[model samples]
Every structure is written in C-alpha cells, then in structure tokens.
Target chain A: MLRALRNHHGEPSVRRPLFSPVNLAKAIGALTVAILAGVLLSGGTFAYMNSTVALPSATIKAGSAALTTTGTPLVLTGLYPGQTQSAAFTINNTGIVPLVLNVSGVAAPAADANSLSAALTIRVDVTTAAAGCSILPGTAGWQGTFAATLPTANAPVSLNSTLAAGATATLCLSASLPPSAPSTVQGGTTKSFSVTIGGVQS
Target chain B: MTRSRILSSARSRIGVAVGLVAFLVLVGSGTAQATWTTLSSAQPATASATTASVLLSDISALNTTYNYTGTTSPLVIAPATLQNTGGAPLTYTLTETNTNATLAAKIAVWIWLQVSGSCGTTTVGTAGTLAAIPALPAGATSGTAGQSTVVCIATQLTGTILASSGSTLTANFTLTGKVGANWQGTDPSSITQSVFQAADVTNITCSTSGHGSNTTATVSWSLPAGATGASIYVGSTLVLPDTSTVSFTATKANVGSATSITIKANYASGVQSAGVVQALDSANGSGCG
Candidate 1:
C-alpha cells in the first residue's frame, strides 16, 4: 500500500482549470467592453459626417461679344472752298462682351491733278447728340482730322471704351476746306472718302 | 501561497489591464487621423466680339480728254476705284445722275466695273467685257484690307455726243451698299463720285460698191451714229444726207461705159472728207464695183 501510494503521487493528476462559468463570463464581458470602446471611438467621426455630408457637380460656359454700325449717307453737294459740312453715324455693339474702340478716317486725293489735297481738311467727333450733330459736346471724347493722326488707345475719344454689348454710340463727321485754299483748287473733286471704327476686346 | 507572492500576482494583473487600455487609446488615435476629402475644379469664363467694318478708297483722275473718232471709242468716260476694308464682304451699287441738262439729254451714263484679278477694257457682250454695275457678285468686294476694285463711267449718245465736241459734261455717280455677308447692326452708306468729259471726233471712212450689175453705184459711209447736219455729194450733185448708204446712177458716155464718179462729204461743223472716184464698164456699175 505504501509503494502504491508512492507510485500514485509520482503519476501526474489533471486538475480543473480556472475556467469556471462565472470567471468565463467575467472575462468575456471585459473583452466585449474593450472592443466596444474601440469601435465607438472610431464610429464617432463617421456618424457625425454621415448626417451632414453632400456631393454636388457644377458647369460653366463661355460668353461672346460683337460689334456693328449703321447710319445714313454723308454727302456734301457743291462743296466750295472755306465751306463745312456735318453728318452723323451710329455705332452699335451687338456682342456679349464690352469693347474698346479705335476710330480713323481716310480721304482720297483730289481728282484734279493740279488741285491741292492738303488745303482740304476734315474733322470727326464723337458725341451723344441727336441728328445733324449741330452741337458737339464741349468736352468731346474724340476729335481729329482725316489725316493719319487717328485717335488711338492712348488718346482715344472714348465712344465707350467699355462699350457694353448691344449698346449704341453716335458720332459726327465734319468736313471743311480751309479758307486759305488757293484759287487753283476750284472745280476739284474727291471721291471715296471713308471713316472707320474698329473695336478691340477689353 | 505566501502573502508577498499573492501581492506580486495582483500587481501583474493590474498592469495587464492598464496595458490593454493604453493599446486601445493608441488605436483610437490612429483611427481618428483618417479622413475623406471632396475635390473641386473650375474654369475661367470669356467671350469675344464679332467683327464688321467697311471702307471706300479714293478714285484716280479722269483722262484729260476723250475722242469719239479714230482709235478711241465712246465706251469709257472717267475712272474711279472701290475697296472693301471691313471684316465682312460688301455689295456696292453704282448709279449716275447728270447735273447738267445739256449733257444729260445728249448722253446716257453707264457703269463699267473691272472683274477681280483681271482688268476688262471691252464693252458689254464682248470678250474681255466689263461686268455691268449694280450686280451682286459683280460689285462684291472681299472682306480684306487694301482689297481694290476698278470702276469707270461709259457713255451712249442719245442723239449725238459728237455735236458737243470741245464741251464738258458733268455728272455724279453714287455708290451705295452695306455688308452683305452676315450683316447686322451696320447701316448702308452712299458715296458720291464726280465725272467730267471733253469730247472729240475720232474716225471717218467711206466705201463704194456696185448694186446688182446695174449702172448704179452705192456709197456706204462709216461715221459716228450721232453725227448730224452732214451732207454728201457725187460729182457736184447733192446725194446722201448724213446717211449710212446711198445709191446714184453712173453717168454714161458715148461708148456706153460709165464715167468715173467723185464723192465728197461735208459736216456742218466745217469738217470735210473726200473719197476716191470710181469708173465702171458697161456690164458693171461705176468704179465702185
């Protein structure tokens, strides 16, 4: 019996682990609480954004600008030396964008070879007046001769430098032959004298 | 177990719990750093204006003098030019109004416009002929700067332009139109061109021919259609009166053969012309045959 008892002590004995139902439940609960804390912290920002999030698309298109002009004929009959004639024209911007204007005039040489072209002078002015252009504004936006000295951007007679689209501007052309003209210029005729107004994108 | 050992075990468990909490805090910090972003892009808006413009250039001087006789024809009178300086093509209509009644009643004005790229000098309905004015494509100018078109006034006498030789004729030719291509907001305009003419006689010719084996000779004359108050004579006998053709019996000699015939023409304006005399045999008419 003593030998048997000694042998039993020598053999390994299987004891119940610390896995009781109460202990297991407690461990599972602790694990669940920790996992819940982590998930809740990560979800806080996501939930706030989900309530107020939005995604939208938009589009933009281009615009256009155009210009046109109209007016009655400018004619001077029996024009004698030292005489002046005045006429008017209308300028309209038929575009979508505003524009800057450049105005100029060109005159042909006298049809008579012996006549003097320099003795004849032409004046062009931009105004807000009505037909006949009898009364030009004192502070005319642009005033110049029919020579190469046209009005440029630097000294532009602003017929509306920022002329809005579909807007109108009126101008007057005044032509004259200086009284100092020589007698030899009699019976001289000039044809195809023209005035032009060009527009530039501002 | 001994109290000290139990105390050490308790300290290890508390440390484990603290470690778990610390790990959770670190994981939460990492998760908090994640984020979502919405990107946006945009373009600048812009627009450009349409271009419309027109221009006319000066005309050249007229010929100093014109002759209706030899070498010269009653076709072209004075010269001028037109051009398109705007951004759009233009149509031009050219019309004439005579300011002087004497000149207007004597002649009718016409327009002769040169074709683009080619200068036409002939009259209408002929090769190298100029296109009539007031034509659509005929008077259309390119929408280009410095583009030029040539024009001239031509004439037709109502009765006779030759009668007014050495006299001056005055008239006005006006060109009017606007941009033809996509025209908008632009007004048509008119430009006046003045013309003057001094006239002269050019050529005079006469031919004689027999009429159908008869003893008659016919004289056909080539003069300006407008010539008037002129007289023709055959051997001192009045015959043709400013007519294109006239016939007269040949004078017969004793031999039965016709004698030569002498023809002369005189204008009321003191101008005179002579034709060669013609003789004919018995079978044929005078020397004209």
Candidate 2:
C-alpha cells in the first residue's frame, strides 16, 4: 500500500498540449529554412580559378579655367563737384584650374573736352564679401586708384592673389571729383568707363 | 522598445549612413577626370570727356619665314602694331592680359625694334634684337604724330615652331602708355592677336624609280635650323619620319603614277612650320608597259 502511494503521489505529472498539424509544419519549415541558409552561406559548392588578372591603368586629367562676372555694370550719375559714389560687382571662377586675376580700368571720352573722368579721382576697393556689393566676408585683398586717362587704360594690377577653382570675390569701386575741381567739368557727363579683369594660370 | 531592438535599429541606421558616405566618395573621385580648358570674354565700359585720344589701331597678325640660313637663332614675327595718335609723348607698357595659360607657357611675347628697315623677303635687319616686355629698353615711345610701331614678338615653343599643325593661339595684349605730366589723360590701347606660329619651308623634292608593280619613293626637304622633326603626306596618307627625309614603298594602287604630297616640319614647342607641296612619280608597273 505504501509503495502504491509513493508511485502515484511522488511521480511528476506530465501535461502535454494537444499537438496541431499547423504548429508542427511551422516549426519544421523554420528549421529547414535555417539549415538551407547555413549551407548556402558556408557549405555551398563554389570554385575560383587560381590565376591573376591585370586591369588597365587609369589616367588622370586636369580641368579647365573659367571665369564669369555677376551683377550689373557699375554706373554713376548726377555728377557735381566733389561728389563721390560707390558701386560693386562680383567675379567668380567657374573653371577647375586656379588662376591669377589681372584687373585694369579704361576711361572713355566724354562729350566735353574736360569730362568728369579727367576731373574725378577714382578708387577701387576689393574685398572678399559674403555676396556681391555686400559686407566683407574675409580680409580685404586689393585696393588701388584708377589712373587718369581716356582711351589709355590703367596698368594691369594683379589682384595680388589667386582664385581657386570655384571661388568668388567682390570688387567695390568709389569715384569722386575732388573739391579742387577745374571749372571744365561743370555741365558734362563722364563717358562710360570700361574695366577688364583677366585671368591666367598661376 | 527593448534595448536589443533599439540597438538593432541603430546599427541599421549606421549601415545606411556608411553606404551613403561610400556613394559620395565614389562620386567625388569621378570629378578628377575633368579637363582644364581656357575661356576669355570682354565687355565695354565708357569714360567720356576727351582731348586727343590714343587709340589701339590694330593687332595685325604677321608671319616670318623660318630662315634656317639666317643669323637669327629663331624667327620673329611682328603680330601687333600700335600707333600713338594723341598729342602727348607717351611711354608704353604691355600686359599679356588674357591667353591660354598652357599655350602662354610655351611662347614668349617681346618688344622688338625694327632693325632700322623692313623685314621682307631679303631680311634687311643686320641682326634681330629681342626685348622682353614689361620693361621696354628704349621704352616703346610713340612719336608726337600718329607714328605706328610694330610690337614684335619672338615666340618659342617646347619644340620647333612650324606649320599649320600648331594650335591657333589667341593672345590678348593691352598697351597702357600714359604721360606722367599733368592733365595728360592715359589712353589704353588693347588688341588680340591670333598667332598661327607657322614656319616657312622651301626647296622640297620627291622622286621614285623601279619598274615593279610597287615602287620605292624617296622624299627629301630642308627646314629651318630649329626644326625638330618633319612629316610627309602622300595624298591623304601621312608618312611619319624621325629625320628630315623619308622613303616609303608605294603600291601602284595606293599612290597613283604620280601623287602630290605636302611635307611639314615640326619646331620646338609644337610649332608647326608651313607645309611645302611636292610631286612624286611612281615607277611604271608591268601592266603599264
């Protein structure tokens, strides 16, 4: 009687859920997929030839040098004795090569023999600005006075610097007829002034 | 979300960021293949109120025969001429404003004084005088009247300056000769010269002998002293040469009984001298007989 009691009470009872075909199939499919992936990754049949190949060498080339100017041409009107006005323009290096810029100014002849160009003192102030005709973004680079002459242009003065590929700089010009003006420019308009900025490889 | 799931999402985002960085690196490497080209443009600005104006009258493109026999080491051409029409006596300064930098590096522009007379077929100058610009020795002074001055240039190439094969190099020059005196307005004269850089070739002869279906032809020519190499073209086909003369076996079918060919010489710095035309007579084939 004691042995029957020990066998019936002391034995741990095993509770099994009802086995379903769907669960069995799902588990089997998951295990099969895992095994197939493992075989494909590390146990697949693959072969490679024990030979070498030589690829053709590549050549490198340099890019072009290009420059462009933005903003309207500098214009100043309503002339009087000792009147000073300032205008600004932007120069952009659009090419791939670095270039040294050369700037020159030319004064065109006015209708009167003694136009404002002869009577006026012109100064060009160049600074690297955030944008055209805006405040300075960097250090001031170049500043010079335009020579007094018409038909004859100013000497080419280097920007004293270089513009790297894809860089921009701004030029500001201020013109004034000094208070000590000769009576010659009283009622005449100054001829248009032409300025050329040229670039050469540095 | 669980820590593991969050960590897994982070790793996925890192992988995506790495992929994007790799793509950008590839694109940056592709930009290295771009070639450097040159560009030049101009705009007009006016300055009125004039007295006597000094105008940039001409940028004449001139030529010179590669006189190998001449005393000058290299030939010179006066491609630009400047005249001072203004009343003031002015001192002239030249600035090579714009040019193809690669081409500019190969050539040199100078202020040349006419050896007193004309540089025509006879070469009247006793000896050629070359002066580098920026500092004109006898400063290129304009006469009181509108006297014209030749802006002579002696161009040098990495090799010989020869014929039409050389690149058409456009050199822009600006002359600023102003009087320092009071009330003297400085006038700027500017011009652009397209220098062809061609050398002259003379006395080229060609001949062929042999009665076979194919004949060997001989061609010989003379070039200036500075000539580096020459090329001979028979009809449309070019016969390359390392020396001054070249001989080639010509088939009757390829080069007719007689063919007209042009021979051009190569100068230092890739300047190609002018080409000379010569006639080549092939041997009479057996069929012709």
- C-alpha displacement of B199 in model 1, angstroms? 56
- The candidate that achieves the highest DockQ relative to the unseen native structure: 2
Model 1, range B1-289, lDDT digits (tens) per residue? 5546656665566567557766765675563442211111111111111223333333323322343333223444444556554433345554444444554454444445655644355444222212122332344433333365665545444333245444454444455434322232222322222222222123333344444444444434344434333344445555555543433444333213544444443344433343435444446544343
lDDT of 1 at B67: 39
Q: What is the TM-score of chain B in candidate 1?
A: 0.36
Candidate 2 falls in which docking quality class?
Answer: incorrect
True contacts kept of each: 0.00, 0.18
For model 2, the superposed segments whose C-alpha errors exceed 4 Å read A1-62, A104-107, A110-114, A130-155, B1-40, B43-289
Q: Pick the TM-score winner.
A: 2
Model 1 deviation from native, Cα RMSD in Å:
23.2
List, residue by residue over B78-165, the lDDT tens digit for candidate 2: 4355566654345566555444454445444444555554433222223221122334435355544366676444443333333222
DockQ of each: 0.02, 0.07
Name the fnat for model 2: 0.18
